[model samples]
Target: MEFKFSPLAYVPFVSVENMIKLVNSIGAETFMSELAVAIEEDFKRWELFDKTPRVASHSDVGVIELMPTSDGEMYGFKYVNGHPKNTKEGLQTVTAFGLLADVDSGYPKLLTEMTLLTALRTAAMSALVGRHLAPKGSKTMAMIGNGAQSEFQCLAFKAVCGIENVRLYDIDPAATAKCAANLKSAGVNVVSCKTAEEAMEGAEIITTCTADKQYATILTDNMVGDGVHINAIGGDCPGKTEVAEAVLRRSDIFVEYPPQTRIEGDIQQLPDDYPVTDLWQVMRGEAEGRTHDRQITFFDSVGFAVEDFSALKYVRAKIEGTEFFEHLDMLADPSDPRDLFGMLS
Candidate 1:
């Protein structure tokens, strides 16, 4: 007898190709803006979610991590890896996949390629924070370390925070050129600079995202002037940092989760007892974001799991009335709950 598969047996899978189509269909900037709203909503309810530092396994070459979180009803997790040397071998420096499952049933619901989703969610997160923390009426932004993430960051700020000009700089001229070219039609002025200092000229928001798995200072204290919002997203793991210690001392640091940021973010360079504001609290209006005009607001971003959970939830909702995903028969559901062995007959 040929048995039929139950609807519960299939899981919705969003492939890389479909994800690209979905982004194009919704427009990248709009997608990220919507994602930012979803993330901020989650942040408002931050206390209800299960939070922990991402579980990381480090090797000499790179690191692999599992970021997991749940809001008591829906559970989500992302498996990601960061290998800076992968670019030398013509591979992505960061790649990821994520899953969402029902908390009560413990069955997988949505599975999607988070590599693209991660980039969108990360840029959205940065811009969302910028909307709150960056200096008021900020227009120009200096983007250091132009790479796969640079274009998305530029667009997110433009769409969400009203940034008009983006000055780009990278160690590699080719990378700068690539970023500039990608942003040509993005409705923002892109300036390719030769040096990091040149890029920071007249910029209010500075974003640093260099991919080096070591302690490196992408921004010194002197480079960061008063009233600038620093989005430091590069230093994501232990021993990998991007800002100078002096810079950290001068800035009012904000982070997603303190326990994780202390271990992995640029704040890792500071002492254990150093004070940093929680981003969730700021979103919930319990804490201040930018107190004064000259007060430097440094966002030590290490890519938190809750943001990924928000991204997964956003994708799950968007794919409901669309064809951007496929149903994968990932579970074996027997017609009779106790007749699992008889399904094959």
Candidate 2:
């Protein structure tokens, strides 16, 4: 008998263009909804996942992070950075890349540039929260911190939550104008506001994805009115939060994972006894989502590893036939499993 396996083959590396085409082909709406379901599924079986807090390196210039998660069968990781000053360097404030690997073989099955995918997934997660938490016939969304994430969030709300009119605001008027121009071209009804408060006027959903990377209070208590679903994405790290502490105290706080979020999400400012609900319970029908039409809902989105897992799965699914991956020699295989030193020799 003869055993045949390919070792010298190239790694399947996915480029940004390949990822865009794959996501577009699968239909952005379907992909987002499916990813939400995937996250929910992972959350339901929470005990199966080998999870850990993301490792982060912070500098005066910016912050870089590595998030890894595994299910004893498959492993995935993403490398992402946040540099608010990158625009001055003619680079995006956030640039990311990620990998999906097989746990048994410990080989990366697919590696992709997730700069665009991160924006997509971040927006998708926000919209999913609104879908489950916001009121029916929700049309308007107030988007604070209108930077790189502005357009992505707007498009997602429109596609997923049926939000047509987006109220946009940023400290930089140019940033607001740029986002408005891009979104208008995409058939989105964008209204640039002078202040974040004006944007919140009549908005059913409020999403904050600022890149300040500090304790910058973007959303004030007065701005957050009733019947609004607040998707807090910017305040995802320590010492960085968008909404005021009073906002979380008043609203029915919901988080992806409470344990990791108590340190990262906007809820960090609150005391230990501060009440909140985990989103998984709502998905499992174990807890209620929106109790009433007037209840203010807050989703403290800290960019969980599970959402990245869902996004990676979606990206790999679209790369079925096409060879969008680059084969890298990151692993070594030997005839015997126990001979780890032999491979090094």
Candidate 3:
């Protein structure tokens, strides 16, 4: 055998800024649609994924959660907190961080602040589902809960669905004002409405990404119109919901992963027997999506870990040799594989 040596390979440590830049370079539409395909690819072989329901720790103040998902090949996890009251204290409502690691080596490849990426991916996921459920010639969208995730959702719809008009409403007028001011330069017809009903008028797609952690009905059956696609995002955890039970019952519901969603999605309010469609089947062409223009369709988005997997993969592919990066030393090395603790010293 010929004598050979290997050099230590450095891992790319992407920051929130770099990750956003990477996503921008790929074009938001490309990143989102590609993410939809990646999520579908992973869901097709759901049995291969090490799917653990999110681990949540709740306190009187707020909630902290850890969502982890892996395919026995690549591992990813996100640490995010939902503190709806944070904004009252002049802080962000959701703060998050995540990591991507190689399952074989248990070595972390990238560590990133997911506060921004969460907004990006959540918006992307919403638009992807809208791609299937929304009616053709849909040009307007109504956005409820115009908070930190509001701008991203606005941009996502335009980039993904070609939506040109965004109607916005929030319980807090300041938040709605913030959203309007931030997105003013995007060249869309932005409307700040007084009520949810006012926002949903003439809209093809309705999105709810509120910060409330209670079962507050942001949208009711009366507010909805025929053929409107609803993207419910805020009702993500126990005791957290944005849609009325009547609305869910009247509409055809689609979910990412049914088991976790049964506990976290709007379906949580429904009886166990209440029917809902798993979106993976739709992606695979096994189940029907938006069967009729008059049928109401709802995507119960609770934020899936698979989106992080897809986001990381997309970032890696686009930023192959970019200069806005870092090399991190986060893994340990041991002379003997069995003596894991020996490398700590």
Best by lDDT: 1
Best by TM-score: 1
Q: Write the per-residue lDDT of candidate 1 for residues 1-345, one digit (tens) a residue.
A: 232698887899999999999999999999999999999999999999999667889898988999999999999999999898999999999999999999999999999999999999999999999999999899999999999999999999999999999999999999999999999999999999999999999999999999888999999878889999999989888999999999999999999999999999999889998999999999999999999999999999998999999999999999999999998988899878899899779
TM-score on alpha carbons, each prediction? 0.98, 0.89, 0.90
Residues 1-345, model 2: lDDT tens digits: 122324632346788887777777776656666666666677787777777888999998888999999878779999998887888889988889998888886778878898888888888888877888998899998888888888888887787788989999999999999999888766668899999889989999988878776898888887787878888889988888988887787899998878889988888899876788988788778889998988999999998887787788777776778655545655555657688677676
What Cα-based lDDT does every candidate model obtain? 0.95, 0.82, 0.82
Clashing pairs in 3: none
Name the lDDT value of residue 141 in candidate 1: 96
* True-structure RMSD, every candidate: 1.6, 3.5, 4.0
Q: Model 2 TM-score? A: 0.89
TM-score for candidate 1, please give it.
Answer: 0.98
lDDT of 3 by residue, 43-140 (tens): 67767878788889989988899899998988999999888788889998888888888899887776777787777788888887888788887899
By TM-score, the candidates rank as 1, 3, 2
Q: Native-vs-model 1 lDDT?
A: 0.95
Worst 10 residues of 1 by lDDT: 1-10
